[model samples]
Target: MAAAMTRMLQLLLITTLIHVARGKVRVQITNMIGYKDDMNITCQSSDDDLGQHVLSYGQSMEWKFKPNFSKTTLFHCNARWCDVMRRIDFGAYEYMKDHYGCGSDCRWMFTIDGVYAYDSKTDSWDFRFSWYS
Candidate 1:
């Protein structure tokens, strides 16, 4: 029957798509400002709003999601501390670049000097950028 054949095809397509779904990625941001300073962070993608969070020294906030199938997923963030004088507005995650270096777990740390990214291979934090403004 044609109807039965179409249903079979639909089930096959659904199964194939499920097997190819992208893996989830975890992103974490930490505050290492020291001296008991608290950092306020806000992060979002074009499609998502992660809301605002305040992280005290040595505290961290994290989230997990799957990258867009189009490979264009991106999340940007703004951080302010020290009475909002020292601040950083930067790209927190980009699928193309970060996926290779970080695989599934991406970690970033904020400090007085700048940002540090976690290198999973070496189990170390690598300096990424310095404060520009």
Candidate 2:
């Protein structure tokens, strides 16, 4: 019985170490909407709701989390500004795609043109997509 317990403890310790080594992923979204507009934002995953926020120009909202072990983690956000009638829904992070693209620090910028994502490998921002009407 003691031998079995020791083996179990070893497995538990290894699992914990692995998780720690992987660390948490950091995501940040900033308002670059200009013209002094306050952007209304809401973000969530299937398992979590980050609630709503109002970000002024140059302001940012950030969060950190570890990717789901099954590799299916995803988070999306909705943004509204300027015209209250207009809103943009966007994919904030997807483990399968972002893990390799943005690395640990996933930064996003929103502007009148569209959404931009930071690419760690190149140390630059890439235009992701335009606002969908």
Candidate 3:
């Protein structure tokens, strides 16, 4: 009986460790227009409104969401100024590789004209940018 109890405790501990090891996706958004433009930003998933913020030039905000295992979650950001608006979108796996069971912390950044997704395993930033029309 003592041996059986020990086995059960081991199984429980392993299960708990697995659950705690899972990490969520985190994104940081910044307005890098150098004080010339103020941006209104909104981030949302299909079923949830992640957050909204107004960033003056050189300001930033951060948002986080848990991994959705049943299906891919699409998160999108919209940035607006005056009459012009720009948008960017990402799938859960694209933003967080761990969403698909690969083991790495997902950290990403979105700026007014670009993005920088950090690869924890490689310790590198995948950066991209474009002019806002």
Model number with the top TM-score: 1
**What is candidate 1's lDDT per residue for 1-133, written digit by digit as tens?**
9999999999998885674375788999999978688999999999999999999999999999888867798999999887778888888889999878898899999998989999999999999877664
The regions of model 1 sitting more than 4 angstroms off are: 1-22
For candidate 3, the lDDT comes to 0.61
Rank candidates, lDDT, best first.
1, 2, 3
Look at candidate 2 and give me any clashing residue pairs. Answer: none
For model 2, residues 1-133, the per-residue Cα lDDT tens digits are: 9999999999998997797568699999999978678899999999989999999999999999988778798999998887675588888989899888787899999988878988878888898877665
Q: Give the alpha carbon lDDT tens digit for every residue of 17-85 in model 3.
A: 666446556666666655677777777877788676888877877766664554365667666664455
Index of the highest-lDDT prediction: 1
TM-score ranking, high to low? 1, 2, 3
TM-score of candidate 2 versus the correct structure, residues matched by position:
0.81
User: Candidate 1's C-alpha lDDT?
Assistant: 0.89
Cα lDDT for residue 105, model 2? 92
Q: Which residue pairs come into collision in candidate 3?
A: none
TM-scores of all models? 0.82, 0.81, 0.58
